[model samples]
Target chain A: MSALFGRSRSVLSRLVGALVVVLGVVTLTFFLARVVSPDPTNLYVSPQADQATRDQVRAMMGLDKPVLEQYVTYLGQLVRGDLGTSFSTGQPVRDDLLSRLPATLELATYSLIIGTLVGVVVGIVGAVRRGGILDHTGRFVTVAGLALPQFFVGLMLLWIFFVVLGIAPGPVGRLPVGLVDPPQTTGFVVIDALLSGQWAVAGAALQQLALPLITLAFAIFAPIARTVRTAMLEALDADYVRTATAMGLPQRTIHYRYALKNVLLPVLTMLAGVIGFAFSGAVLVEGVFAWPGIGQYALDAIQQSDFAAIQGFVLYAAVLYVVVYLLLDLLYARVDPRVRL
Target chain B: MSVALAEGNLLDVVDYRGGFRGPDGEVTEVLAGVSFGLRRSTLTAVVGETGSGKSLTALSVLGVQPRGFVRTGGRMLFDGEDLFAGGPRSFERVRGNRISLVFQDARAALNPVFTVGHQLIDVCRAHRRLGRKEAEQVVLDMLERVRIPDPLRRMRQYPHEFSGGMAQRVMLAMALVSEPELLVLDEPTTGLDVTIQADIMDLLVELISSSGLTACLITHDLGVVAQTCQDVVVMRSGTVREIATCEELFTAPRDEYTRDLLAASRLVEAR
Candidate 1:
C-alpha cells in the first residue's frame, strides 16, 4: 500500500514539475516575444500612422500596459481558460490551437511508432552483428539521417514519391481538396470520420498524411536508432548477457529477452525526448507539406509577429515535452528496479 | 592441476587455441594452448594473471566466447562425447544443465533491472519446464542452500542492494539451482573483502563437498587455490607452467613463474 502511495506521489510531483515548466516557458516567451524585431501592432494599425493611432491599437490589445501588469493580466486570462486572440486570424488562440492539435498529435503518433519499430529492429541487428554489414549500414544511416534536416527530407519525398512517380497524394491539407470531410465531433477528422462511418474521408485523410508522417518519422529515427544501437552493444557485452548465454538459453531469448530488456531503459529515455522534440518541433516539415497542424499555425504566427499566438505555442510545446518526460520517468522507475528504491 | 583421472574423466579439454579477430580480419591469439580435465569429484584451480586467458579458457568450455574469439584448434570431450562434435548445439543441451559457470564481478553478472527472484526464476525455468510457482520455489530453495538469510525477502531485492559478498552468493545460488554436475567459477571473490572472500570460499567448498560435485575455479589468488582446491594449474601468459596437486605445487614449484607467484603469495600472507 505504501508503494502505491509512493507511485502516486511520484506522479503528483511530475505534474507539479510540469506546471513549473509551464511557468518558466510562459515567463520567458512573454518577455522574449516582446523584444523580437517586428512590433505586433504594426500589422494592425498602420506603421506610418500617427502616435495616437498606434497608442489606441496597443491599448485595445492590452499591450500598452506595463510589462508586469500585462503578464499578470495574461495569467489571469489564462486561468479563466482564454489563450488570447490571434492578431492575424481574429480567432481565439485556444480554439485555433485546439482545432489544429489533433492533426499534429495524429501525425506525431504515427511517426513515433514508425521510428521506434524501425529503430529497434535496426539497432538489434547492428548490435548483434557488431562489425557486420547491417551494423555499418546502421552507422551510416544514423549519421546521414541526423544531419539531413526534416524539411529537406520532406521535399525529397514530395519529389520522389509524388512528382517523379505520382505515387503519393500532393502537398494538401488533411484531405484532398474536393473530398467531403466527416462530421467534426472529436476534432480529429480521421477518428471522427471513422466513428461516423465515413471510411472514404478517413482513407483520404490518411493518404494525405503519408508523406508528412514519413518525413517526421525519418527525422525522429536517427537519435532513437543511434541510442538503441549504442545501448544494445553495451548491453550485449555485459556480464549478465554472457552469463545468460552460458546458461544455454536459446540465442533468441538471450539477445531479445535478456539483452534487449536491459537496453530498453536508456533507449526509452532517449526515445521520450526525441518524440517530444519531434512532435512540437516539426514546424519546417509542416511548412513543406502544408499540413493543417499547429506547426503551420505557429509558423504563420511567428512570420506575422502575432505575439499572443507565439506565447501560446511555446506553452503548448513546453507542456507536451514535459508531459512526455514525466511519463518516461514513471516508466523507467517502474521497469528499472535500480532506480525505484 | 589437471584432474588425475585413474578410472574415467568427466571433461577433457585438449590443446585449446582461441583468439580475437581484429578489424583487419586477423586473429590475435589469446589462448595459445589450454588443456585440463575434470574428474567426478575434484576441485581444480586455474591460476593466472590478467590477460593470461584463464577466463577465456573457462568461457570456451561453456561455448560462450564472444563473436571474435574463435577456437582455431581444440577439442572438448565431456563424458566420452566430443563437445565440439555438434558445433555449439551439443553444449546447448549440456550448458546450465550438466555444466554451469559463475562469472567474475557478480554485481555486473546480474542484471540490475530485475529483482533477484525475477532472474532466478527465469534461470530455473530456462533448462527445466517449471511453472512460475515451481520455479520460484526452486529459487528460494537454492538461496537457502547458499546460506543466504531471509531468502523470501532477499528474492525481491535488486543486485545493487546486496553487498559484493552477498551478490557472489546469489550468483553461486543461480549456478547451483539447475543441479549441473560440473561448476565453473571465474574469480568469484576478486572484488570482495578478505574476510568475505574466505567465507565465500568456505561456502563454495562446503557446498561442492556435500554434493560431491566437480568444480573448476579460475583465479589469480594462490591463497584461494590453497584453501578451496585439491588441484592447481599454474598458468602464465596463456600457457600452463605447472599442473600439480595443491600441496605439491606450493611446496615444490616447477616453473619460475609459479615460484614468483608463490613468493608474492607468501609476502602478502606474511604482511
Candidate 2:
C-alpha cells in the first residue's frame, strides 16, 4: 500500500515538473520571438501603409501594451483556453491547430509504427547473425539513415517514386483537390473514411500518405536499430544468458525470451528519443509532400512572422514531449519491476 | 571417500584441450590437457589460482564455454555416457536435467528482469516438463529448502532486491530445483563476506550430506576445502597439479606447487 502511494506521488511530482518545464518554454519562446523579430505591425499591415493604420492594427491585436503587460494578458488568456488568432489564417490559433492535429498525428503514428517494427526486426537479426552479410547490410543502412538529412531524403524519395518512376501520387495535399472528403467526424480523412466505409477515399488517403511516411520512417529508424543492436549484443553476452544456456534451454528460448526481455528497456528509451525526432522531422517531410499538417501550418507561420501561431505550436509540442516522456516512464516501470520501487 | 571413488566416478573429464582462436587464426590454449574426475556422492573442490582454468573446466562440463572458445579435444563421461562424444548437441539432455552449475557471481547469474520464482519455474518446466502450477510449487519448495526467510514473498521479488547472501541462496535454489545428480559450483562464495561464505558453505555441506548428491566446488580458498570438501583437485596454470582425498592433500601434500599454495593460504589464514 505504501509502495502504491509512493508510486502515485512520484507520478504526480513528475507531472508537476513537466508543467513547470512547459511554462518555462512558453515564456522563453514568447520573449525570444519579440526580441528577434521585427514589429508585428509591419508584417500585419504593409510597408506602403501609413503609421496610423499600422498603429490601429497593433492596437486591435493587443500589441499596443507594454511587453510585460501583453505577456501577462497572454498568460491570462491561455488560462481561459484562448490561443489568440493567427494573423496568417484569420482564425483562432487553437481552432487551426485542432483541425490540423489529426493529419500530423496520423502521419506520425504510421511512420513510428513502421519505423519501430523495421528497426527492431533488423536489430535482432543483425545482433543474432553478427558478422553475416545481412548484418553488414543492416549496419550500412542504419548509418546511411542517420547520416542523410530528412529533407534531402524526402526530396530524393519523391524524385525516384513520383517524378522519375511515376509510381506514386504527385506531391499534392492530403487528398486530390477535387475528391470530396468523408464527413469530418475525426478530422483524419483516412480514419474517417474507414469508419464510414468509404473505401476509395480511404485508399486515396493512404496513397497520399505512403511517400511521406517512408521518408520519416527511414530517417528515424537509425537510432532505434543502433541502440537495439548494441543492447542486444550486450544482453546476449550477459551472465544471465549464459546461465540460461547452461540450463538446457533451447538456443531460441535463450535468444528470444531471455535476451529479448532485457533489451526492451533500452529499446524503449531509444524509441522515446526517436519519437521526438520523428515529430520534428515530420515538419520537413510534411513540407516536401505538401501534406496539410501542423508542420506546414507552423512553417507558414514562421515565414509570415506570426508570433501567436508560433507560440501556440511550441506550447503544443512541449506538452506532447512531456506526455511522451511520461508514457515512457510508465513503460519502464512495467518492463522492469525494479523501477516500480 | 576412497570407498566412494572405488564405487566409480560420476563424471570423468579426460585430456580436455580447449582454447580461443584469434581473428588471425592463431590458437591460444587456455585449457591444455586438463584431466579430473568427480566421484559419485562426494564433494570435490577444484582449488587453484585465478588463471588456473578451474572455472573453465566447470563450464566445459555443460558445453557452455564462452563464445570464441573452441574445444579442440575433450571427452566428458557422465555415468559412463560420453557428453562430448556427439559434439555440443550431446549434452542437451544431461545439462540442467542431470548436471547443474551455480556460477561465481550469483546475482549476475540470475536474470534481472524476471522474478526469482519465474526463473525457477522456467527451469522446472524445461527440464521436468512440468506444468505452470506444479513448477511453481516446486520452486516454492526449493526456495524453502535453501532456507530463504519467506519463500512466498521472495518468489515475487526480482534478483536485484536480494542481498548477496540471499541471491546466492536463490542461485542455489535454481540449481537444485531440477534435482540434478551432479552440482558444479564455480567460486560461489568468492565475492561474499567471510561470515556469509561460511554460512553458505555450511548450507552446502548440509544439503550434500542430507541428499547424498555428487558435487564439485571450484574455489581458490584452501580453508573451505579443509572445512567441507571430501576430496581436492589443486590446479595451476591451466593444468591439474595434484588430485587427492582431502585428508591426504592437507597432511601429505605431494606437488611443490600445491605445497606452496597451502603455505600461502596458511600465511593468509594466520594473519
Q: Estimated TM-score per prediction?
A: 0.93, 0.95
Q: Which CAPRI tier for candidate 2?
A: medium
lDDT at position A12, candidate 2? 93
lDDT of 2 by residue, A248-294 (tens): 77788889988999999999988887787566436888888898888
Per-residue C-alpha lDDT of model 1 across residues A284-331, encoded as one tens digit per residue: 988999988889999999888888899888888988888888888878
TM-score (C-alpha, index-matched) for candidate 2:
0.95
Candidate 2 — which residues are off by over 4 angstroms? Answer: A279-281, B1-7, B267-271
Runs off by more than 4 Å, candidate 1? A1-13, A37-39, A131-144, B1-7, B23-25, B267-271
TM-score of chain B of 2: 0.95
Could you report the Cα RMSD, in angstroms, for every candidate shown? Answer: 2.6, 2.6
Model 1 steric clash pairs: B1-B232, B1-B233
Q: What is candidate 1's CA lDDT for residue A245?
A: 76
True contacts kept of each: 0.74, 0.74
lDDT of 1 at A64: 77
Writing each residue's lDDT as its tens digit, candidate 2 over B1-271 gives: 1112234899988778888999999889988878788988999999999989999999989988888988888678888888888877778888888999999888989999999888888888888878899899999988888999999999999999999999999999888889999999999998999999999999999998899999999999999999899999988777888889998988889889988998988833453
Q: Which candidate number would show the highest lDDT if scored against the true structure?
A: 2
